[model samples]
Target: MFLDEHTAKQQIVAFAKSIFDRGLTSGASANMSVRIENAWVMTPTNTCFGFLNAEELSVVGLDGTLLKGLPPSKEFRLHKAMYDQRPNDRCIIHLHSTYATALSCISATDNSNVVPTFTPYLTMRLGPIAMVPYFAPGDDALAESVGKVAAKHAGIIMANHGPIVSAETVESCVYGMEELEESCKLALLLKNENANTLTAEQINFLLNKFKK
Candidate 1:
């Protein structure tokens, strides 16, 4: 079920603080949006996740008009693109978390699925992560690129930037983002080792069993 605006604001603020308190994201480098009927209650532009004010959160109509509160995130298009493609998803979180951003800075062998399946949680929660080529932050082109892959990816790693995760609820979106970060950490940690990544069959089984 979609959240009502008030609860969406509270959930956004609560989870944003939770993420920031845990060092999942730093400063004003992250943003989140939650679907509430025909509009989205989103974090305001330049607001730190740790310091969000629920009463001051922005609300944008589904067509992208600002309906209330402070201005929505400058990267609002990124969230819009994903919401448009994933109709069933109610929340989207984009973070510049360290490990995931570090992974983004590297050249991925497969941009279609950047993170390797070092563990099942990432795949179970986010499926394959698409890596969009770098575009300056807030560039509409970045949103366009994200739109191209959002339908197939519940999670994405923007090159030279970081990860964006979406889910049917606030909790799932946060957990998926954490899983993405953890997966990136494991991938970097075992980069030089002969890590026995999960095989194709195993990954497919997970995709079928856990993904909707």
Candidate 2:
């Protein structure tokens, strides 16, 4: 069911609290946004997710105007960039989850698809995980980078940062983020061993069957 503005606000808060309680993100490091009608309800700047109140979430217009609540997150542009590009995506979750953030710090030559196609679930839910070059947090350049990458992929990992996932609903977006974190963890766990990853054909079949 499509959530109204009021319900979207409550769901955003509830999702935030759940992620915070589970250590997906801590302090005020991550940000979330949910589209409602012509505007978006987003987490406020410097507010801990565990303590978020529905009224305190920021509501921003499509044109980037703050319509209500406190100041929007510094990374609001990153969220906006994705929304501007992907009209079908209703929710965006950017989190500094432990495993994903740790994977971001690793050195790699190929920035594209930082996390290899290790699981069918990750491959189906998230196409290729784009790895965007590091930009100062909140930089307009960072948003632009995200926009370019998000044009082709629903999930991306910022270099030395974390993951940003956009989905059709808040619930699925949260689940996708969790899958991303777990996939990253698995990649880290098998960094030394010659892990058996999915073949290109298998990935292609999954993509064809369940492309999101």
Candidate 3:
């Protein structure tokens, strides 16, 4: 059955609160959205994630019309880009998580800044993450850049912007992003240390063991 807009809005709002209470979104810096009828349901523009209400959420159709509530998140284009590029993505969680955002500021396309280290947990949850270059907030350029990487990842780090996770369910999307942040935090901690990075052989072994 199709999701009633209000129900989906509430879920997104609840998930946003969870993200904020866990110190994910800070101030008015992050937003959340879910796909709906060729459009997207998202938290309101300029609202704090910790206090979002369904009624305050907005709906933007595929053609970019504001069909319900207030104006949709400033990153509607970002959501649209993912929807367009990734057919399986039903929800998207965008946040300015501290550790992940910190990693974004310094990460590169190379696995070194991602989950290259020997960690089965990160590999299982993130699969392969992507790092997109920074773009001005709310610019179509950001969406365009995201389109190039969406097909390659379940989670993406917006260099200097934060992270966005696209998944089949809102819950899984949030969980995956939490894993992404934790893995990034671990990577940051081991920076410059002699901690053994995950070798191709070790990663392949784990992959084969778990069929990941």
Candidate 4:
């Protein structure tokens, strides 16, 4: 279900407002982009999600030209890297959500799948989340690291940064981000407890049954 540019812009605004209102992200720390036929409708740099105007969203060409509106986010390279790796993904959401950011600060035993599978929903909504080692914001290497893993993982957590998720639609991308945040919350909450995470067998079953 490819979206026209107008519809993509509207959806980005609506969902961004919802994400902002719920405190999923704050200030201008987050960015979102929707891939249209020849371009991407993206949140502008330094624009607050709560106050986004659909008309002000950047329309960027595949070659990174700003075709319309304000300049694309400074982290536009991150979005582009993911899109380059996953041709089927239509929307990309990057958020500095609280719990997920907190989780990102910690070292993971497995960088390939940093966030633990606390429940089935996280696995069903998002597959294993890869981890990118910390790099300065807007660093090209950060995008390079993401591109290396984006093909295998729809979700990613950047060390000392936050989560980036992509999906076939804006709604699915938002939902996956929410699930990642919530799963991080659960993981933090159970850090000291003898938490019962889903077994490998169960995870394989879910992957075979529901992975997209």
| TM-score, candidate number 4 | 0.99
Candidate with the larger lDDT of 1 and 2: 1
- In candidate 3, residue 10 scores what lDDT? 81
In candidate 3, the residue pairs with backbone N, CA or C atoms under 3 Å apart (3 or more residues apart, or in different chains) clash, namely 118-198
Candidate 1 lDDT over residue span 184-207, tens digit each: 999999999998989999999999
TM-scores of the candidates are: 0.98, 0.97, 0.90, 0.99
Q: Tell me how candidate 1 scores on lDDT.
A: 0.94
Put down candidate 4 lDDT per residue, 1-212, tens digits, no spaces. 67999999999999999999999999999999999999999999999999999999999999999999999999999999999999999999999999999999999899988877878998898888889999988899999999999998999999999999999999999999999999999999999999888999999999888785
Model 3 — which ten-residue stretch has the worst lDDT?
109-118
The lDDT for every candidate, in the order shown, is 0.94, 0.90, 0.80, 0.94
Candidate 3 lDDT by residue in tens digits, 19-69 = 889887789888888886677888888988899878878888879899889
TM-score for candidate 3, please give it. 0.90
Q: Which stretches of candidate 4 lie over 4 Å from their true place?
A: none
Q: How much is 71 displaced in model 3, in angstroms?
A: 0.3
